[model samples]
Target: MSGWALRTEGLVKTFTLHLQGGARLPVLYGVDLSVASGECVALAGPSGAGKSTLMRCLYGNYGAEGGRILIRHRGETVDLTAADARLVREVRRETLGHVSQFLRVIPRVPSLDIVAEPLVARGMAPDAARAEARALLSRLNMPPALHALPPATFSGGEQQRVNLARGFAPGYPVLLLDEPTASLDAANRDVAVALIREAKAAGAAVVGIFHDTDVRDRVADRLFTVEPRPEASRSAA
Candidate 1:
């Protein structure tokens, strides 16, 4: 438990876009990050400051321009930068969990399936997955009768809770949350924060990108901020 769960060294990322004028842009200039086992770290920054991009890099959604990402899995250390998509997916599905800025739910998939997806992905039997999902949903204060319903029509807070239940369903050891409480009202925000604390208590290493100061203060054991350095104007001497 003393070892790090995730570590990144000299991580870098850039975005190049083709416009009518075709210009390139640069983002994420060599970031170094590390999260200890069972630690809760908050990533906070202004808009367009690359917090999401950093998450993407850590999760292997986007390849870093230059750096290494190391993930500790099942008593072994693996360099995520060198792992294939299939391997990354395996780690993501089994050992690492992610909650997105926007909830991504299938149009026709039932809420139970959404929560059970992680366990099923890890090859648990359908019945077992359903049982676990139900327990998690109940822990979120979800009504037992509504466990079978599609969550699209639920309130924003309910939807976020469903999202939480799904991400936590498999009990993945590490969780990366992007604005997990972004859409909640005051009361619901408290619920979301409590759930977050529960995750940390259950020994999951959690990194959350927070926009709200209160949310950061509530859930963060450590904090990070992204700042941009000013580019001095060029003048001929």
Candidate 2:
């Protein structure tokens, strides 16, 4: 019922993968999604359905061929799709968070620093960022001893928890998660779901892609499915 935190209209992206025969692949068709502040949505579909690509486009890591991404702040809506890269980056630093399908912990960056990176970019002092990072990690039940080690050596579940902390550390209004729980074990998977609910309760609009039906059912206030078009279905038939 509150303002929308993020939205997309007619989003489309195509990639031309150079195959052995010089063939190209068109990945995403026109896709539209919207999320209100404090709400959560799950995107479920088969592999190659462009869910990750859509998440990238939402964070401005990739561009969309045709669409608008609007983010509301205060009383105004900023057109993220039209904004320049610098503006996009700034907005992301200030009010948006993204967790990718693959874990991308910078080599040699300590785990605490990894969680503190976004807040540092937003001009928070080192002490404050670390304090906040510690709080989030603690919330996720991370052991205190692991905070100083590089996350590269962490277990998959630990690393994923670190990823979740980083995305949530900034308290961004829009959180885009691409298969965030894929690397977790059963127990850690449950932790990830709880963290997602916390994010929404903190007023972030959460959109996540997942294959686990339990995850989709538990975390999503609304659900949307990506399916093949009628043309493709008929063609397959």
Candidate 3:
């Protein structure tokens, strides 16, 4: 229940703009970040500083152009950049959880099922997963009536709550959050902060991008500022 839960070494990512005749744009450059169990690290930087890109890379949604994304998976260190597709899927199911700023799930899937799908995917019984999902949704103040309804038509705040519930429900060892409290009111923001505190207290290594200074200070143990790299500019085709 100690030491580093997640770390990146010499990590790099680049984007190739096809429309611009394959102009290459590099984002991260040898970024070193380590987060310990039971601690929360907030990513701080201005717009276009690659904070979102870093989060995506950490979750294996984007391939690292170089270096490694090391995560503790089932008590072993796994380099995500080198993990095969099956292993990456397994890692995502059991070890790492992410909450994006926006909610994106299958259309017409009820809110409850959306939150519970990950748990069920990990082999938990459907009933148990649904039970946990119901509890999380209730805790997040999503009305009971909306539980059986799809979240696609929900307000931004409502959809965000469902997203948070889904991400926090699994209790993954390492959690990545992007603008978690963006659409919530003050009261719900307090609840979101409490959930983050609880996650850290329960030994989840949390990395988050919190533009809200008040919420960031309340939940984050420290800040990791990702400075913009001058070399990230697009190179000539």
Candidate 4:
């Protein structure tokens, strides 16, 4: 196998505007991206340029209109665009990890359990998973006291910490981070950067959208610009 861990060929995505008489809005088209193992690729683009859309598509959250989203899974390259829901879930469990901008989990679930759930799903014993979660949370400055409580009432920074710990704990080969450090303070931001660097060192392929130039410079090996297609951006009535 080559060094590339993830790549997309001619990827395209579109959204239908039901409120606008079912008009079609195109976001991304003909996107060809490649990321290697142990590298971080930052998505650079304007606010309306569909970087998030592309990220969601890459993660199989949004079904692509066309193209192939390929990633190395279990030593084989699998096309996520062609994968079934079950295969996608399996891939997410074993190969791909994503840290979105917000923490979304079952309401009232303790922060520790929230972070440990993924590990448990991956076959780690619950006790061991929670132990790993606790250590990671502590490293992110999440107090032990707060670990037992639900993060629904936590501040933005605190919730972000739980999200980070959960996503990084699984040791996935491919990671997608959407503004991982956006809500963090200086100290936590530094820790986030360190975690990213550590992941890369351990051969995790990372793709992220970091508006913070400092964070981008620290972690991104290169930038892939998502240029807006004016025609696509315009809704067809």
Candidate 5:
């Protein structure tokens, strides 16, 4: 309910290559960023610069090694970095929603049902959930015939649209999007951009990784660049 929906201070993350003798690879180092309700913050960086990693840390998908991932929910600030699994799940269910670049769902579930799941979980009637999902899919230009089929057989762009529909359906207070426009054509990309702007106008705090500069320019209120840690700093740590 505050001006800032999310903030991170000196956040850090490292991945261990257990398959390769437990070698450590640090992706994010001391990242400090914030996003406010009614604002969209785009993550800008070259490949491998940890933009996606930082987003995941915000969504509580990746555990940070250091620093704070603070989220404002229902007029209280919660430290996502230190929150337990139950708390994290509760927050995600009620406040934060995420759309990864890939669509990972049950292999046989219809696309409509997949998109309706979040709304249904939030206590919306099943009929209303599916109706909203259908509307979103139509806006995204998904064919009506494909709505009842599993997205597992859909093309990458189609699957991404389904992912977008699902992510936007919940209308959570905070949303994290990774490459939302990555697989869309110009027309569909424009649709995606409009949907993002609509979410902003509806007062959702958005943090996203948009490789498409035009989409980013159109939707982002500001940019947060994620830079790789210097070798000297890494060696010292």
Candidate 6:
């Protein structure tokens, strides 16, 4: 709710395709962006424009080739782009949360436990975390009978709901979401929007890829468009 919770200065990323004679594919180049606490910033662009790639870079899943990904964590600013692996892990554990388009969890873990794991890792009692997870899943309209089942058995929409519940549960200071409502129906999408608004109101800086314009409009304070640099420019670089 004060200064910027996240900022990227001249961020650059490229993928080297070993299969294609080490062709360098530049996805992000000198991308500068910022999101203040209590703000929701939407990344908008055509498909394959690197929206998701930027989110992953911000989350430290993908390394940036240049520039800084500055994140405010525990009252300190750390550049994730250059931070050590341990520091990045600590930041992710205590300050950043991410919700991806797909659900990835241990194959045999129950949906309830899957949603509660973050909370438990952060020192919440297992019972309390499970209770909170159950409540969130219920709010998302997940059936009670399916709570004990593994998310692997759930439908795409249902798995997405579980993913959302987990990402929102920790209430981290910074959140990166990639199509958070991608597999949802209208009703569930509305619920997801409400949760995003609630996060912003609570002073979480949110950066997201929202393909659904209506949801983007409802939650985004601003938009950052990712445009691929021309091939000629890449070669020159």
Maximum-lDDT candidate: 4
How far in Å is the alpha carbon of 192 misplaced in model 3?
Answer: 0.7
- Once fitted onto the true fold, the runs of candidate 5 whose alpha carbons sit more than 4 angstroms away are none
lDDT tens digits by residue: candidate 5, 1-237:
347899999998998889998778888988989889999999988888899889888988889999999998767999999999998988998899999999996889999999999999889999999999999999999989999999998899999999999999999889999999999989999998998999999999999998888899999999999997777766665
Candidate 2 positional error at 163, Å: 0.6
Residue 97, candidate 5: Cα error in Å is 0.9
Give the range of the ten consecutive residues with the poorest summed lDDT in model 3. Answer: 228-237
Candidate 1: where are CA atoms >4 Å away?
A: 19-22, 229-237
lDDT of 2 by residue, 1-237 (tens): 347788888776765546645444455566778799889988777776667777788888887777788887545788887898777877888888898766687899888999998999989999999999998888778889999989888888889889988987888888998888887888778878988888899889998887787887888998766553344533342
Model 6 C-alpha lDDT per residue in residues 188-222, reported as the tens digit of each score: 99999999999999999999998889899999999
In terms of lDDT, model 1 sits at 0.81
- Of the two candidates 3 and 6, the one with more favorable TM-score, higher being better, is 6
**Which is superior by TM-score, 1 or 5?**
5
Query: Clashing residue pairs in candidate 2, if any?
Result: none
TM-score for each candidate, following the candidate numbering: 0.88, 0.88, 0.96, 0.97, 0.96, 0.97
lDDT accuracy of residue 200 in candidate 3 = 93
The lDDT per prediction is: 0.81, 0.81, 0.93, 0.95, 0.91, 0.93
Comparison by lDDT, 4 against 6, better one: 4
How many clashing pairs per prediction, in order? Answer: 0, 0, 0, 0, 0, 0
Model 5, C-alpha of 228: deviation from truth (Å): 0.8
147, model 4: CA deviation in Å?
Answer: 0.3
The root-mean-square deviation over C-alpha atoms between each candidate and the true structure, in angstroms, is: 3.1, 2.9, 1.8, 1.5, 1.5, 1.3
User: How close to the true structure is residue 224 of candidate 1, measured as C-alpha lDDT?
Assistant: 77
